[model samples]
Structures are given as structure tokens and as C-alpha cells.
Target: MKALLMLLPLTLASCMAGPDAATRAATAPQADAAVTISSTTLSRQHWQLRDAVDGSNRRLDALLGLPDKPLQLDFSADRISVSNACNRISGSYRIVEGHLVTTQLLQTRMACADPTLTQRDTTITTVLQGGPTLILSSAGHTPLLTLADANGRTLTFAGMPAADAHPGDDGDTAPQQP
Candidate 1:
């Protein structure tokens, strides 16, 4: 009886120490797993804001511009730099499964009354609360960044900026540094 009781505690402890099979299957691949994405991989992935139905409004518009030049995304150990046609924006980013969270974004403050950029920023910040799948697609004239779900459905949002402006139009619109 004493030996059985001791074994029971050991079994329980082991079970509690790490994820179970189901948990592992459901969770995002960790940094080590082959499924994990490297900075190079993430930079290469095509992503777009969710659609208007999913809050793809003014903010998403301002963040991305016409694809005249391929948008340059420099992914670092903990931060991201995107060279939109008008401005250079940098922020901290994290990925879970297929979802990405960008925080504390600091953009070069140039005067563009284009409401879309402001709105796009707001939308991006708000939608981070809702999980969205990150998909990279290059089928269109511009690279398409699809924010979808596990089932591969793009979340519909509102207020996409017209493909008029460049992202790096701000005073700091220079080539990004290494």
C-alpha cells in the first residue's frame, strides 16, 4: 500500500510537469520545434491586415502602402522594422502559433492627414486581442498579408486604406539600418 501511494504521487508529478499529448498537439511549436519560424522565415512571410469585417479599417490602411517596391521587413531577435512606401516603423513583435502580437510601435512622425494610417494603427492594436492567423501570399500585384484563422478564413474588418500612399513617407524615410 505504501509503495502504491508513493508511485501515485510520482505519476501525478510527472503528468503535471509538462504538456500532455493533446496539449502539445494544440499548442504553437516552440522555438526548438521544426515548426518554429526563424526571423528570416517570418520576414519572408506575406501578411495583411484582417479585412473590414474583421476590423480591417483605417489603421491597417496606414500601415501598408502600394507595393510599388517590395515592402522590406527586417525581423530581429525581438523587434520588427517595416519599410512601407511612406514611413519606416519599428515595434516589438511576438508570434504564437500563427498569431502575431506587435506592441509599443514607434513610427516616424511625419504629417499625413490620411486618416487611414491612424485608423490602421488603432485597428492593429485592437485586433491583437483577437487571435488571427498570419499567412504570407504573393499572388497579387502586391504581397498579400492575410490574417486568418486556423481554418484559413481571413477575418473581415472595415476601412482599408486605398492603395495610394507610401508607408515610409515620413522624414525618417531612409533605408533601414542593419
Candidate 2:
């Protein structure tokens, strides 16, 4: 009877010793540098920007002073769209090897005395020049964006709120209760 009791605990412990199902699922192949981001779901994946730091200098952050806007990145086969923050910029893009190159970037002509937007535009252009093999991560709880290199070196990026384009009085009041 004592041996039976001990054997019951031993069997239960052995069953629990194996890995959980979640751990085993992540054993899939890692994304390679050459993986092309083509589909809409892949393009709309949330990307929080990380500050691009070079040595001890913060060039992009110094220029734009962090993003005050929420932006959406919508990419297709040959073009990329950036909406929100009072600007809807679209342009053609090409991937060379694993790098992303953008050209003919045209944005809405709404005038803003703030120089930050221009600086941000420059920052985005420069980062994309490093190719499309960029790594992205969440920036805390903010909708911010972060970009990194193949070797895990982070580049400069920012997240901003999309422009207020609601049909009614904009996003001013809370939703009415049911």
C-alpha cells in the first residue's frame, strides 16, 4: 500500500515535468533577413519606434524631439502609406536585397509652423535607407515605434496618434452609453 502511494506521486510528477504547449510552439523557424513583408496583416502589425542611438549621440531624437503624433504604417507591394497626425504620406518603395528604399514621398500640404514634423520626415527617410531588414519592438505602453538593425542595433523611430478624422464632432466626447 505504501509503494502504491509513492508510485502515484511519481507518475504525476513525471507527467508535469514535460514542457508546456506554449513553449513547444515557439520552436518554429525564426524570421530570416530576407523575409519579405507583403501581406496586409503583416504590414499592419504594430511597430513601436525606438530611439536611434549612434555611439553617444541621439541625432533623430534631437531633431524631432520625440513623436507627438500617432501614425499608421500601411505597406503594399510597391508603396507604403503613413496616415494620422494631420499628414497622409504615401510613396513608392523598393527592397534591394533586404534593404528598403523609398522614393517620391508625397505628403499632405497642410502647413505647420512646427519644425518637428519636417525633422521626423527626414528621420524616417534616413532609417528606411538602411534596408527593410529592420527589427521593431513595442515602446512601453505608448503607441510609439522602434526600429532596429540585423545585428539588433536600434535605429530612430517614433509613434504618433492618427489624425482626428471622425465623422461627427471628432473624438471630443466620450461615447454615449447603450
Worst 10 residues of 2 by lDDT: 163-172
Best model number under lDDT: 2
Each candidate's root-mean-square deviation in Å?
11.8, 11.6
Q: How many residue pairs clash in each candidate?
A: 32, 20
Which candidate gets the maximum TM-score versus the true structure?
A: 2
* TM-score of candidate 1 against the unseen true structure: 0.40
TM-scores, one per candidate: 0.40, 0.46
As a TM-score, model 2 comes out at 0.46
Model 2: lDDT equals 0.50
